[model samples]
Target: MTTTATAGADAVVVGAGHNGLVAANLLADAGWDILVLEATQAPGGAVRSAEVTAPGYLSDLYSSFYPLGYASPVLRGLDLDRYGLTWTHAPDVLAHLLPDGRAAVVNRDVDTTAASLEAFAPGDGDRWRHAYADWREVAEPMLDTITTPFPPVRGGLTLLRRLRVSGALRLARRLVVPVRKLGDELFDGDGGPALLAGCALHTDLSPEEAGSGVYGWLLAMLGQQVGWPVPVGGSQKITDALVARLVARGGRIDYGARVDRVLTARGRAMGVRTVGGATWRARRAVLADIPAPALFLDLVGAAALPPRLVEDLAHFKWDGSTLKVDWALSAPVPWKNRAVAAAGTVHLGADLDGLTTYSAALARGEVPRDPFLLVGQMSVADPSHSPPGTESLWSYTHLPFRRHWRAEEIAGHVERMEEVLEEAAPGFRSLIVGRHVAGPADLEQGDPSLVGGAVGGGTAAAYQQLFLRPIPGLGRADTPVDRLFLASSSAHPGGGVHGAPGANAARAALARDRALTGELYAGVIGAAHRAVYR
Candidate 1:
């Protein structure tokens, strides 16, 4: 590897994931010289793609859907279409299959989606429509609030103004309730509840978990507005577009430059030293797009962190691991419900009870016999992903983090997943032209940020969300270390393709550059810390 003795930049960003790229772009746009160092030869991290199964088939190795990506204020502000990024939406957004040959389909049209739920039961359509109408009123402000800095004073005030004090309190109560309980109270049929429950499965949370209702509600509402769109080519197009935009703005990225330590002086980050014996000096700030544990313990070193933070890091809980599989199919998936074929995504497993069992099994450190699968029919969503008449499809399931799966065990799990799919779509196995399976270990090997395959940065439990994310202190992007920022998904708002963490980090870094503003914001955050952690 080529190594430079020393380099200087206004800001040094560790890792070139989407978050890191966002930081680099924003800083560069501000006329600051930026340098992004990625450990891998290529950037994008988990948001990557390749022909894993067959030569002509394009498969997204990790993330595929972009409901959050589309709704993200930071991303929407960037005219990515000029940089060769286009979105493709399927005829339907998502479908959750049931054992009874019925499906709960989510469509871009609220009325149509409600109709699908109404078919399962009489009054569910009206209930869904009513809920969706309420969502529309507060959706924009809610997105702004969650995706903004901690405390969200401005966004919170806006929400309060929109809904009076009692209404705002009621909304908060609804957000904290478990999806299962909310579903039971709102809808009489299984279709609406099952659909919401399946959305909850995207996280490590079970339907019975309190904060899980928020994730389910958010994704479902975003689907109605954005339709779970994908890139026209593949997921890598997103990374490519970001890289292009960053480079155009005078940002520089060095591949295969793994940071070994964050250089500090007088309690402030100065620069970074790489494993390859090169140093990159940061004149302004250092932003880490890595996991929190790796940032504090490994790179910054435990000796540099506060004892209390070190303790918190030791006890930090991670979400469950993941098992992903991609297939190159000779024909489309033979779904029992043909309408499912028109959808971009599918959820398979048992009903709500089965989903609860799956979550319980993960918590118990045991693999579920019937794993819940999140399936992506890439070719169905974007035909350019594969050759004509063929399909490029992928699916992923959650597993217990403690389970150390061997090669044989991994194969067994893959077979079991195939069986589950076959049960839903008969003869699915016969259509497979080639296949690739990635267990939890493989996921980590591909991207260290996905520690133990915990994709959402860390467990997004009720106690670990919002103000308590990554730790129970102030949830701002600024760290205890001066001039150092945590710009990874491990920060507040956690994971997904949304660039909120990066944007928040950038704002913090920019604030620090202006001393008065930084001091004022710091005081506000300190007060919030006392209010929340006290």
Candidate 2:
């Protein structure tokens, strides 16, 4: 049915990203009449993947691999496997190629990884295992606790309670420390820190950036244990699977509908206004899966925003922009190391200085002459991606967030990117039969959620985490408006393909009806200030 003039649903979701879809599923599961308003022609925001270059070639427009996919219990509970979503794993040899023609093949077995570490620095591998074991104690619960919605006081306490009284104290100290310190404290040489820093860079957090240490080691270890794999078909499979489940439950999705404003009255969120002038009203709640700044500043209107919320918005720090290059290859990326060639996701930074210089230059508003690039040989990782014996590769580097990009600049950048790839693999540029470049503007045109093309919503830096995320004083998911809530990567636990933010928002909305169920979540976020920041 077409939405009537006075039409209303139990819940209204703005943006059809995976988080919004996850939230919509939870509402529909509870028998709520739900309406999902999408700005794009289809669902799946950053999680979207498409065939950008060739007939058989597929490109991940945004997010591709998922270590977060495996860690998200909320996603696990959704029983995605029953929905036809399957995951593949690469071998333990997750490789990091250096300019010296040497590479680190991280294996799943701790002993094997230990041996790899040992090669770089004697006894360093053993230290890595020791550090990993310590992380193991908190990894599960920390992943659970941090991803909790606004009121995770009990969840926070639960995590705190679970911490080894002694270990917790140590972790508490480490939590605020930078990744450089954490890596340096644990490793005897630069290899562990270099490789680990590369992983955290995946989220746009520089190694020098505080709070990134957690993400760096966390994902690195997770990838070692579970090789970063794409869904069987491509990243689109994950989004399609989620949308299929939502539609199966009678959910309504309006595509090609770009939202321009969030309608509110009496300090409460009521609905949204699209660029087409269509209005959607929700009696229960509004879940926004876009950036918080885009919500309060662009969509929600600055005047309607609470004063503190406005101040909080000012303090928000968006990470740098990104430059993505996709290729249709005639064959696989013939990595110098045979083992790394077989690995699913390869980190290709020549050395520590190369990584630092690239990131530092991005900070200084100049593209690094030799940018640190994350090279994904998609077809080689999964054979079904391209024509027989052909492959599709994705490599990206961070660029300063400013100005529109030109076609010539992007072309030159692609050429430079191929040169970088060829450093690890001898004849990489020759195989490119097709290619596409997405600059900041292209990303903006593609998905508005990538504000200034900062793909992870915003940087996943420690300062912008949990309580301080998006802005300080409002970390509980709930915005200044009564029923409006943020359900995007801008929220707690930051960015990942994980549906935690969406799940967290749905549970929060459900709390208004259930009351006590989500109180623990609210409490945790509330406690951060009650305990420390205040």
- Which lDDT tens digits does candidate 1 get at residues 326-346? 999999999988979989999
Q: Please identify model 1 stretches exceeding 4 Å from their true place.
A: 1-4, 519-534
List, residue by residue over 92-192, the lDDT tens digit for candidate 2.
Answer: 53677777766766777888878877888898988888877877777777777766774467556766777747767877777666677777888887678
lDDT of 2 at 192: 84
RMSD (CA, angstroms), candidate 2:
3.2
Off by over 4 Å in 2: 1-6, 514-534
| Candidate 2 displacement at residue 267 in angstroms | 0.9
Which candidate tops TM-score?
Answer: 1
Per-prediction count of colliding residue pairs?
Answer: 0, 13
TM-score of each: 0.97, 0.93
